[model samples]
Target: MAMMRNITIGQYIPGESVIHRLDPRTKIIATFLYIVLLFLVNTFSGYACSALLILLAVALSRLPIKYILRGIRPLAFIIILTLSLHFFMTEGHVIFQVGFLKVTQEGVVRGLMMVSRLVLLVVGTSILTLTTSPILLTDGIESLLKPLKGLGVPAHELAMMMTIALRFIPTLIEETEKIMKAQMARGADFESGNIFQRAKSLIPILIPLFINAFRRADDLAVAMEARGYRGGEGRTRFRVLRFTYKDVVALIFVAVFVVVVSIYF
Candidate 1:
């Protein structure tokens, strides 16, 4: 359950900071550019700059550093696994060996690079979700995809699906936690077990979790229908989105950061 609390994805913290006040579109575009630059850059110095940008943004947002770092804890295993893969597979001068397994100098360098990339990718984009509310995020996505509608894309539906998926992540985690506790009270052993045994023990939990998930989804659909919520066709928003000077400034800042890091260090 503590692991669930550390997940910052799909979670938003309200604040009066400039980061929070910028249009969601600006945040979304900046996040996209940041992610693109992550893959394009090949140097540790570039990753360092990316890390500093995230840190500066976090400070400007008035959010606790620990709060932002919490998001990485849940994905720590994946990061470690990624490092292991790079460290073992890349070929170079042998640095260490164990019973036919060789660790290379190039592998160490590549592994650390991969680890840096993964960490920055997570920390950089997390700022967007931390500062922007789900509703505004959905609107921003839809607005950005609006141009694709002329090319036969279901922009509104696509945005709705993405938003719903993200919005339900916390809900699903809470539901799973609840079911696990309930099962534990009934003497189910989910803890002390080998890998296989632990996975097998989750059967009782997954069954009821899926049922509750589907039931909730159906309930939401019915409620929407009852409220006359048809497709996004001709739909009007209660809160309209507008691009202001703040958004322009935010874009310019991100553009400069991404360009400088991509071309230089």
Candidate 2:
């Protein structure tokens, strides 16, 4: 369960670097455009351009490359599974054959490309989450979705819910680790069984986890009530969000990135 403790995907690191100082709205929009660009990428040249931008962002953020990438460790199995499925399912000129299974050169190339796309997607999103605080992220999202409030979208509430969920990821992970250890101490075998048996072993853990989650939710609700909290109606923020020249520059950078990757690169 050590994997559960080191989840850094949604966790933020405090910094005063350029990337961190930029408006959260700018980061959110840029991250979305980058993800779309990743899907449009097919050639090595496109990937190279994307990678260069990522490196530049990392450098500007003053965040360690390894620290950003550590989030991928828990997802290693998923990456391998995706690559394996594409390698065997795709058909082309057979490069290797073993009885009923065949490996094709085309499959190899496609699998590698798929892996690259996945890695880029994760890294791009991680950059945004690592640099932006949850409160600022919520504010940015609510501001962007303000238009939908006319259609009864409850934008502020939705953003608040998402922010709360992100904030609780690490807490949930730590809780899961504690529960797993307690169960293991009671002679529960999680690692010495087939897939079905292993899943069955998790019943004890899930029950306590759900109970504790509900309890925590109740406590939070009580606390909010005690503080006289209400919905987002007529709420005024202490920190007003403003779009600066840096935000405009970020927008231009994304526009150029999309144009070059889609049309020329």
Candidate 3:
């Protein structure tokens, strides 16, 4: 049996909260700066400040904290692997030892920092997708990149691809859940095995999933072609984007937070 509802990163939940109403460009810039801030911070205090900021954003978004945390479940394997590698391999004052493995004070601290970075990164991104509609997100990204088009960049195409990719994440998750359930009903085992065995079991699930994904993609391309769809050149947008005082305020807040935290925190 498999469950898929917990994954919320790629799905949008329409809301009337202030955070949701902010300009998509504002949110996009904020998310990007927040990720950069994550890598810039080197102290526990910096991480704490970053966590506080994320919490503030989450509160403003009015999304359920528990619901937001549910998205972290899918990253358990990566988080665990990160913790294991850093906690056991980093050189520092040894805090504990067992058999051939040991934990160090620095390692523990570094592992916690890395985990915090990952969680913050995920929550920040999840909020962006959960609050902004896909079409709006694409518009914002294109708008931001529009200035780069003079350098031979395909701004609209890049934005469309990014938005489409984000939009497909939830679709892929649902597809995976369906495939897993269908396979399991046929007596396929995905859980009752060692790590390597479990990974091997997933091959059956992934192969069909990829095939289905490609099929859907091909159908989408044909449908677009039939509808007279072309590249980004001269494409007119139905919903035009404009900035408000709120957008300016949001951008200022993120910039100040990043700059102050990086320089003074």
Candidate 4:
């Protein structure tokens, strides 16, 4: 479970950089816009521009390059699988053929494009999560969704749930690690076993995790009720969020990147 040990969500390194200081809502919106534009992109030049923009954002976030790459390590297998499938399945002029496997130029090009798109998308979104704290992100979401309240949506409740879930991801991962270690200490061999046997060994871990999760939920509910927690009725926020000049500048830069990619690529 060494791989699982390093999994993190809502993981942010404290920083005072420009990317870190922007409104969380700005980061969220920019991420969405960037993903949409990435798909609209269809040329190598466009991808290059997008990559450059992503690199610039990552640099501004001031997070270590190793940490960002580590966050993406889990996706390496999927990216390779996608590239392989595209490289073999698409039809075009055959570039290579061996042992009944045919590779085409178009397939190769398409595979590279798809892989690039996935990489850029992951890096772009990870930047937002890596720079902004989960609490702030959820607060931004709730504030943004306030308009939906008119449509009878339980926006505040939904946002609160999301925030709580995000906050607990790291905690749950640590708990899972401890459970795995404890089971291993009791001679529970997860490795060197058949798939079915290994899966059965996980039952001990899963049962406790589920039980504890439910217990925590119940306790939280009781605490909230004791505090007279009503659902979004006149709830006041502790920290009010406001977009700053940095947010405007960021938006402008994103817009320019989009336009340039669209026109030149």
- On TM-score, the candidate that comes out on top is 4
- TM-score per prediction, in order, is 0.79, 0.79, 0.76, 0.87
lDDT of 3: 0.88
lDDT of each: 0.88, 0.87, 0.88, 0.87
Off by over 4 Å in 1: 1-9, 96-99, 162-222
Candidate 3 lDDT over 1-265, as tens digits, reads 2456665545778999999999899999999999999999988899899989989999999998776887798899999999999999999899999888999999999998899889889988888988898878888888998888999888988887886787788789888888888999999998799999999999999999999999988998899789888988777878889899999999999999999999976
In candidate 3, stretches whose alpha carbon ends up further than 4 angstroms from where it belongs are 1-9, 161-230
Question: In model 2, which runs have C-alpha deviations exceeding 4 angstroms?
Answer: 1-9, 165-228
Arrange candidates by TM-score, descending.
Answer: 4, 2, 1, 3
- List clash counts for every candidate, in order: 0, 0, 0, 0
Q: Which one wins by lDDT: 1 or 4?
A: 1
Which of 2 and 4 is the better model by TM-score? 4
Task: Single out the weakest 10-residue window by summed lDDT for candidate 2.
Answer: 1-10
Q: Report the lDDT of model 3 for residue 129.
A: 85
> Model 1: how far is 187 from its true place, Å?
8.2
What local lDDT score does residue 68 receive in model 4, on the 0 to 100 scale?
78
Candidate 1 RMSD computed on C-alpha atoms after optimal superposition onto the true structure:
3.6
List candidate 4 segments past 4 Å from native. 1-5, 170-198
